[model samples]
Target chain A: MEISYRDMITVLHGMGFGVLFMLAFSGAIGVIYATTVVGPQWPRSQWDNAMFRFYLISMAALAWLATISGAYIIYPWYRAVPPAGTTDLSAYPRALLLSSPRTAGWHDIGMEWKEHIAWFTPIAMTMVAYVFIKYGPRLALHRQMRNAVLGFTAVAFFSTAVAGLFGAFLNKYAPVRGGPDIVLMQEK
Target chain B: MSAEHQPIGLPTGPGAAAILAAGIGSLALGVFSFAGDAVPAINRAFIFWQPSGALSGVTITAIVIWLVSWFGLSRRWAGRDVALGTVNVAAFVMLVVALLLTFPPFMDLLQEI
Candidate 1:
């Protein structure tokens, strides 16, 4: 899976753009709220009470499991997928990250990214849970929030399952081939 | 502060919104950025299915957990104990989402070729 320098450049550009997008969207929104809305809203909810305290304790347990399990299972699988020399193609479908012979050294770096990125999942999940505990339910509109969470979770789960089956099939049989020297091989 | 003082829980309005917004934003950026690049043949085959691997089972699990927690914490949320119900729900939801993303979909697309 030798990628051309041009392809490498494109992939790097895409990564840069992704980081920028995150900064613009989440980082910017966070800053604005912390400075204005979050401060003014202040702490309407407090965990000082017993029930809140119990719930947080339980949530902590669940979160710890999620983090440990996710790291143990997902991280290794994620690292194994790309092998070492393949291009840093978009995880989304269709975009083949092109890499060249000259830029082969970069493959080591890209592999490192894949190995480490999934580890962030546990940290992110933990943080998300912590925030929810601190603020309590932010959705004053109970009906709306419940419905939205149900719908979103439903879609996410279904889509991910379908994707998994598809990948399994592809890995089993229909691997695509690239340049002549590099024959596609399936890994366990 | 016991281990209970700092356990992972659920997200409220701001937390939920942040995750939702970020998910939508990432999906949007993924699409926008990849639109111009050459779609890898392997990616083409599995792209549509990736979301399936990323979102399904965890979503179902999260919903179930939330409902159960809602019932269990009903006593507490009634002002008897601090607010626990919502935090429980949020924690469950976060766990589901995080677990699902670990599915092979996010990492295996490139390997197909």
Candidate 2:
């Protein structure tokens, strides 16, 4: 089961879209939770609180996975060059074939920030979720913790949006070479 | 005011400040250690690993600081006085700084100036 770079990009693109959709859905749910449950001092059932916790955990996991996988696939510079003895170049796209470092374009810079900032998302989200679980029940019950959780979630949402934007730019401006166009052997 | 509504325990005050300082300091070390040609010896030592190693070092330091601070300070503090506000604000600032350091324009500017 060999997969070409083009196929990888296609699969990744689909996965990215799915992650974006999930983020949006989760963000909406978060807003609802903040406004209706947290704001109104509504008596939340155990199941309701559990569902919110689950949503937070899911969003964190999805954001972590998406950011890591996206960075790995989108940044060709991070990859190691093939061994000197091997001549196969068909597996990689031209954009990834650079022998020298290229000047950092705006998109590249955006990705740099995105990649580093994304490292905090999982930790921040997990902390918020942990606080919710430890405290238990209505957000109104724990005002300070609720504010902190809301702040962290807001940052998480921002980071996810930025990552999606960077991915879109990379896909549009730095596309992978098609399978048919890849040369099986490179000239030394 | 109920037991169930009490804040979760976390490091606070000096403990949290220490952890935050260590984390940010490690991150700064990582960024500056890899930037430019100022330290040829350090670069040569990390020739195979370079910036990745430096970055990982920062993360590792942060984790250690967090764990140590949690154990050392979390038990000492009462729930409501946890000072989570301070920790959260510091963490947020550190996150922003980390991002800014990695931003392309910042990196370019640092190189030029």
**A1-188: candidate 2 lDDT, tens digit per residue:** 35556646645643554365345556534553564365534425767667766766676666556644544444443433455666654333232434325623533465455555555555555555555555545445545556656665666566566666665555454444445343546667
**Model 1 lDDT per residue over A44-111, tens place:** 44532334334434433433343333324332233234545656543311223123444332223332
Deviating ranges (above 4 Å) for candidate 2: A1-6, A13-43, A71-107, A176-188, B1-80, B111-113
Indicate the docking level reached by candidate 1.
Answer: incorrect
lDDT of 2 at A28: 39
Segments in model 1 whose C-alpha atoms lie over 4 Å from true places: A1-141, A174-188, B1-13, B36-113
Native-to-model Cα distance after best TM-score fit, residue B113 in candidate 1, in Å: 27
Best by DockQ: 2
Error of 2 at A101 (Å): 12
Model 2 reproduced share of reference interface contacts: 0.23
Residue B9's lDDT within candidate 2 is: 43
Point to the candidate with the largest lDDT: 2
- Give the Cα error of residue B45 in candidate 2, in Å: 6.9
